[model samples]
Target: MTKSDTITWIRLSAVRLPLPVPVSDAKVLTGRQRPMTEVALLFADIATAEGHRGIGLTYSKRAGGPGQFAHARELAPALLGEDPSDIGRIWTKLVWAGASVGRSGLATQAVAAYDIALWDLKARRAGLPLAKLLGAHRDSVRCYNTSGGFLHAPVGELVENASAAVARGIGGVKIKVGHPDPREDLRRLTAVRERLGDGVPLMVDANQQWDRPTARRMGRALEEFGLVWIEEPLDAYDAAGHAELAAALDTPVATGEMLASVAEHRELMRLGAADVLQPDAPRIGGITPFLQLAALADLDHLQLAPHFAMEIHLHLAAAYPAEPWVEHFDWLEPLFEERLSIEDGRMLVPGRPGLGITLSEQAHAWTTEVFEAGVAP
Candidate 1:
């Protein structure tokens, strides 16, 4: 491939991948939603005239798969002959191509698939891992587990899950909080804490279920547990409340995973609302906006613990200036042929070029729809 090489084709696939089991969280306990049994993944594959290829993915939990697929299909034609190496430029072009619906949320989410593909393509073109391409700060990151600690699990299950995670080399454990009965929430926390012991890192997430007074009260109670962080105790958009809570609490406040734009995250930084910023690359328009946000967060001296998509976040987290954390979820494991190595409580960076992942046969078997657009050589 040369500078003259251009994108030849782009393929998009929408797969309705079923979860092995339904998982519930604070949202379910609050009756705002039901257990989630499946996820919708939008995968973008970009190929160039020189036979170079790259893959990227974005996903929706309950809804927006069709919307994202429709939006992605609508924008694929615009990249038929553009240089995939021109990632930032292409990101701007795609954002404007779908400007009517706005740049955040679903529109940018759709663009995220393509944006990430370009980044992956560029890294592969260099024969380097994305982290190395971006100048990595660390070769491994501290890892934690959330899949085993949902609110639906029984106390014994929670302990077992935490034990299993610890035995598997996960450095920290986070469980769902914000139960209908605050006592029950505390009980769960205490049980998990007692089981994990004091030295281990422990965290809890309210999943945006607590109001101001409740958040404050619970934040006060949570102080005794020596939590590494308390996450999303208020609504995702309540920057002011979070700032106030951060000022009042001893535990670090972490949020921003649910936020969908750089502008929204800037508000968090402006107010110093959070101690740890948990940005999801796919959720906020892929690596393009994620990097933009990371740069801003770096300037503020914020801790990075990006939420979900470990395969993608691992590389991005590695590139972060501060020592960052990456989440570990086994749900997406079936979609990729390779597995990440967890050793000594850290997830090691793979030496494979690009994102270092290849889709599994099962991933294709679950695909509900696929489409192609662009000029293939």
Candidate 2:
């Protein structure tokens, strides 16, 4: 006999995790954004009437953290008495509940937390890791370190960071490019490549700062390095521009991390805009929608390299059909009690059930606000 579990309670917390130092990329260098000093995280904890619990999270950089928290607070009650196993159904309902906000961007991001929580709940109930529950293709995924490659670091520091990450068992290193001075960008990459040698899986991210002409020139110039990919060479929305850029360069063009909806990613694919699709699980409305998008990307035979939040992406990447890359940023390590394993250039899928994570005392200490829904003592 089967007993349907009803989601009876939901708790949302807003956290501000401070970075050890200000972070900068081409977005900062180009004067489009300020250096980042902290990240705003929104966490969802869902409890079922049967005493089953699950956790999920989403985050924002520089701004919009509070907005996501607020949205989730308003959206939490909708889950009360609903089947926790009906992830796709609940996701659709949440999207329509905030229909005024449209189906993408902030709305999707907020709903993402709950949607992920449901999947986590489902996996925990089945006593399996999320990747295995999702039918993983591998037990581990290739990894690359991006935190040490921000634009603010000097060339010496960049080389040092790359060297350290490689030695630490990361499969590759991705440095920030798209400097105001193209020559300076070239100079930095030359030094990094010279130090890392040709065998390493090296990559560069423009962070959407390059125009077509600049991207074209840099793409041509970058050919000698044999990079695994060039990320966000143009604005993320410029599918046609990215398609042209992807065609012009032998190196695969990667983008879509900034996109907020399946439609946005579909447009990128319809035009063949990118060779590598870098969707973020939390950013695109959690693993529910991410799996939807992954199916589409796989159909195109495109490469996958989910952006940040390695904790969540490692499981998702492992489940991907094509070998995928998971970006590593240890900034969120303090939030969780469990740590991921990296060995021989890959991140192993944790065998623990669900997300295989529990919030740390530090997470509770950093929590700025809390909201509870449909649960009363």
Candidate 3:
């Protein structure tokens, strides 16, 4: 067979690309103005070696590099001669080797992009969508509106945006809260809850902005609203604080986006830091590790609610029983190949191979010549 037809090896590299235009209005905390720097991942296609490719763009609000792109670059050399289809094995090898180096944090984040890209390529080559490859039993996964559109707006505006989401047939909604004043935060929560009504699932995330005592107080105050859960109420690393809050309040505690390693998940579970574990596919090493973490969460009887990147998270959640809600944020759709659709409050998990999502024509053009970042062609 010709080398092109035979399954061979994969090469890895990344593009230091900028968004079409600067997103100056983006947020982190306190409504500060910032621009986003994306570290786009491109895996060489040799086996399913078509023009097929995938992009895993890292969203660093501070326009950060090196640190963001480090994992893809560091792990690429080790992956040069490996089979693109051997994703599970590749994931295991990396985990075992990086065991002492640590699995959560930056190392896993980087590995996640590479593994996701490889999976994308594999799906495209096999002429199958990601959902089908993963043995999808359903065509779509339900999603919650996270607008993530704006966080520092006035109370009325927040309600309007949320109402818009509700009108769109979205069954769930998530809002950001971490204001220093307890009363003011409560008002915001109360306003949102009032707008969404009693039965709707309303969840709030503190972004790890509150301390232990303050978090407990806020959790208690918000309990009357009957929040689905209170998220990242304390520092992501403070297992003790999480445990304290979890034990003190009636509201279910949820956290894990800040955690990058499986060991941390183990500790958090042991401490009862949270009743819900939120794992981001790219944040905690990639699909393989995320799956492992989901398994752990399953064993712990905790619910799984992934942080963001709803497109990819849908598949991961679909594969596991624990994931109940997938955060819906469309900020990165312009950079992707295809947009994952949400119908009747559910997202259609890509039925094609790999992640089931494709690179959109605009995404390809943007990442390729125009974005000044070459994608695998």
Q: lDDT per model, in order?
A: 0.94, 0.93, 0.67
Candidate 1 has a TM-score of 0.98
Over the full model, what C-alpha lDDT does candidate 2 score relative to the true structure?
0.93
lDDT of 3 at 357: 55
Give the distance in Å from residue 336's predicted Cα in candidate 3 to where it truly belongs: 2.4
Residue 122 alpha-carbon offset, candidate 1, angstroms: 0.9
TM-score, one value per model? 0.98, 0.98, 0.82
Q: Which segments of candidate 1 are over 4 A away from where they belong?
A: 1-3, 375-377
Cα lDDT of model 3 by residue, 134-229, tens digit: 555566666787653245567897888888887877767887787756666778778888877897788888878777777877887888878788
- Model 2 RMSD in Å is 1.0
For model 3, what is the alpha-carbon lDDT of residue 310?
79
lDDT per residue, candidate 1, 1-377, as tens digits? 53688898999999988987888988998899889999999999999998899999999998899999999999988999898888899999999999999989999999999999988988998999999999999999999999999988999999999999999998999999989999999999899898889988998999999999999999999999999899999999999999999999999999999999999999999999999999999989999999999999999999999999999999999999999999998899999999999998999999999999999999999999999987654
